[model samples]
Target: MNGLFDALERAAGPVTFAPGATLLRGFALEDAAALLAAVDAIAAAAPMRHMVTPGGYTMSVATTSCGELGWTSDAQGYRYAACDPDTGLPWPAMPALFDTLARDAAAQAGFPGFQPDACLINRYAPGARLTLHQDRNERDFGAPIVSVSLGLPATFLFGGIKRTDPTLKLRLAHGDVVVWGGPARLRFHGVLPLAHGTHPVTGAYRINLTFRKAR
Candidate 1:
């Protein structure tokens, strides 16, 4: 266990993107197995599915959630709901491991006392891309957003507050955790189209778990 922690630290540590954003590379390495297990349990309760946007277009990426609230989109709009619209039941509870890791990452990123009530899970396949958008459905932007990347690598686009503002491209790999809050809380961000590849953990797919404080 000590050796594993040492390996993870050697791989990467906290990398600051700005005053309010920090990337903790390899932060989830040790907990990857447990996290995946938790995800499996959540998916079993609430299956992953592609959702349609208000614009009447189906999202390329598949999504699901576990926590008090789950994110969903339809002709009405994108919003968080207390239950899975498809299942008509409350989303699976967020695993303790997921909660702990998110809080730890948030503290390391300079945001303490972070308690997230929603954990959005996104699955991307080859050619799947997320367009620039802000996470505004949450009631409080004061809490930081904790995002963990798993499986295949992806290029993360971090943009300014405005959609048209300049963007920075950063490559993210498995076990990476990004925490952003304060001024960076409402920053526009998105994921580039995934490339065809098979990861040792999740073959031909990339899984992202984003923890948020939503009421």
Candidate 2:
């Protein structure tokens, strides 16, 4: 806890991308503990597992979700499902703290009236990397994507609209919240492979909570 607090105290201020993405550094500093507690409860209910992509490759990142709909992928491709495929039960409801944090983060990023119905929790261990890709599975494009980072530090790959376009590596630490919408909503983005390191709050793994309106 002390380590996390100290790190947050040293984090940089907000960063705004040209395409409308906003990174609110250390925005979740005070709420991180409660946020993590909520994550633990959600994981206990749904459990985290690596889902296979349509290409039949297993993702290195373990994932789970809470809220009205959950993002899922398999040989069939990516889609939003109302219930967890494993348990055939609805995923745990989104925690109130989680909801409030997301909404507040979005508002801070200039997207008011944000109401996310799906929160995807991704766990990344050392060497885990997510390929650059655009998020387009959701029904509404008007809503922005609010992502919260916790635990280990990560290099975020913020790319242009095209896959071949140039990308910028942004350092994201625990408590950093990034909100992207409008012109930046569909831009390609991903996380670089995590290096071997440990965080006080989450040990060696990093947890990312991505909230979206995925009706």
For residue 87, give model 2's deviation from the true position in Å.
0.3
lDDT of 2: 0.92
lDDT of 1 by residue, 1-215 (tens): 34433453454668776668888998998999889888888999999999999999999999999999999999999999999999999999999999999999999889999999999999999999999999999999899999999999998888889999977777788999999999999999999999999998998999999999996
The TM-scores of all predictions, comma-separated, are 0.94, 0.94
Collision pairs in model 2: none
Candidate 2 local lDDT, 23-57, one digit each (tens)? 89989999999999999999999999999999999
lDDT of every predicted structure (CA atoms) = 0.91, 0.92
Lowest-sum lDDT 10-residue window in model 1: 1-10
Minimal lDDT window, size 10, model 2: 1-10
* TM-score for candidate 1: 0.94
In model 1, residue pairs whose N, Cα or C atoms come closer than 3 Å (at least 3 residues apart or on different chains), thus clashing, are: none
